[model samples]
Target: MAFTPPKETYTGKVYTLEIGVPPDTVRFGGENVLPLHGFEGIVPSRPVIAYEIQDIPPDDWPDTVKKPFKDVSDDPVSWAKFCRDALKARAIALRLIGTHPDRENRSPEDAAKTVRDILSAIDVPLIILGSNHTEKDASVLIAAAEAAKDKNCIIGKAQEANYKTVAAAAMANNHKLIAMSELDINLSKQLNILITQMGFDKERIITDPMCSALGYGIEYTYSVMERIRLAALLQNDATMQQPMLGDIGMYVWKAKETQARPEDVPPWGSLEERGIAWEAVTAIALIIAGAELLVMRHPKAIEAVEKVVDELI
Candidate 1:
């Protein structure tokens, strides 16, 4: 008798939802709905890539990293074009960072005009970012939502701190909204629940669970996102089911792995190389853990992450 391995059970494919499902088309003017879990449908909308555009020059960014965009960074519209034309950015994220109180505190009307300029300049999907300050984002995102109302854009980051105004604006204007929370699973679900309770369509909501750099509590972030996605796909948790977003560039660029100076530590190699690696790796990690969309900076980092995405999808 030929040696035989112990009989083991074989089960049909369990249908692991490695890929997200794009939401059903709601026919909201020129915009398309993005789905997270395959339960929504087929096609995950190719995991949207939103190229970051700052309302003001990113003076806070290190010189090594900011040098690439120094030329076009002078103009927000031109910067948006560079991302679309040169970088081949599938989506654009325009941040009105200039409206912060310490900054120009530019009026909401001015920000709306800038939105018009950017909307006219590019055809790809647009994402409007508030200055991250609770008060400023509430006002600025409102203006952005109105300006790009029919053109089909995404306005974010409705948080517990400012969800009332932000959610109202995005819902009124028929734009997708990102419900953001600190790096906690419960908070993420809670925020999504609150936003939907406000009469926002469930399909139009995206979840931002907050991102952490490579070494800075990344494991916790990963676990939180992993649990969220699993609950959505397996347990069919409505609040956690919305597609998740990883603001990779923002956190990675601020971490020690990306900010370490060569002068201070000779062991660390080139700053450019380290920074790119940190961003690329962190983004890939998020995808593995079920991030359906990402907001990133740096051309090289984008290229690297795109390659990984292509292979996985």
Candidate 2:
């Protein structure tokens, strides 16, 4: 007799989310098994990775990551097109970092204009992100949501402080919302409940339990994400069934491993290879932890993660 592998099944499935308009949309989640555990149950879609761009130049990004977009980074539209056409990016995430009060202090109107311009320039799905300033994001995301109305973009990052207003904006404009919380499973579920309480359909929301780099508390982040996935599947918790987001680039690029110069940290190897590998490893870890959508920088890093996803699925 042949030996057989034991398999486990689940009672719940993640909500499948579609972003962008028809003919160009991208979908993820809707899996009844844990990540890459398709042998046990249905796993309908592969993870989606979106290249991260900013409305303003990435002046603060370390040289290693910034070198790729040097020529087109000066303008958001040009930068977005480069990602789509040159890098073959399936989706794009535009962070309005310049709109932050501490940065260029660009107004909601300016952010809206940037959204319109980028939308016109690329056909791929766009994820509009605020600078993570809770107070300012409420206003900025509202304007950005309206600007991308009917385009079926994903507008985000409604936190506890501004979920009501931001959720309302995304609902009214017909865009998906990203509900982010600190690295706690309860907080993650609570935020999802709060957003749905406002009448925003829970299926349209993406839960971001937040993200951390490889050496910087990543184990904690992974545990929180894995527990969330288990609740969604094993416990059949509706509130925890939404797909997860790993905002990889922003967190990984800032880590000391990615930014430290080889000369300064003699044992760390080449700066460029170190940064790319750091990002790829962080992204792969999060994918295995149950992230269905990712926002990443570094073309080489994205390529490496894509290869890994292919082999896993």
Candidate 3:
């Protein structure tokens, strides 16, 4: 008699989404198995990684991550083009951090113009991100959605404070919306419900249950994401079935492990390699936990995760 491996069957599947105009679009999700467990069920798409850029120069970014794009970083268009043409990015996420009231306080129109310029410069999918200011994002993302209309972008980060307005913009412009909540599975599901209740199609939503670096409550983040995935796959919960996003770069790059100088922390070795490893490890953990889309910085970190994804699939 031949020995047989036990395979678990899941009833639910993640919604498949396509971003960017056709011929240049990327698709993800539509998997029914646990992450990387393709042998157990259908796994039509591997995870997608988007290189993170910004409307303004990445001045706040640490030297290690910022050095790579030093020449083009000053101009958003040039920065976006460099990522697409030189870095071979699959997708680009333009974070409108300059629009924050405390930052440059750029007007919505300024953000819209930046969106148009970057859209014109790059054919790959674009993910338009606000500066995580709940109030500012409501207005900024609305303008950005209009500017990128019909180009098929992903407009995000509709949190509890501003999901209605942001979700409306995404709905009006026909772009995907990323519904984010704190690191709680219940909150994530509740936010999704609220968005869909507004007549935004649930299938077009992506769940961002927030993100954390490796040593900074990453285990909690991982647990929430895994439970969400399990709820979707095992319990067949429709509210939890949307694909997840791990905004890896922002969180990973901020951690002390990524920012500390080797001289200051002699045991950590090179700062650059340490930063890259921090990002890669964080991203890989989320991917295993059920993140179908990742927004990451550091070419080497993205490269490392990409290689791992290839091997896993």
Please give the clash total of every predicted structure, in order.
Answer: 1, 0, 0
What does the lDDT come to for candidate 3?
Answer: 0.94
Model 2 agreement with the true structure over 203-270: per-residue lDDT tens digits: 99999999999999889889999999999999999999999999999999889899888889999999
TM-score (all chains, Cα) for each model: 0.85, 0.99, 0.99
Candidates' C-alpha lDDT: 0.76, 0.94, 0.94
lDDT of 2 at 18: 94
Off by over 4 Å in 2: none
Candidate 3 lands at a TM-score of 0.99
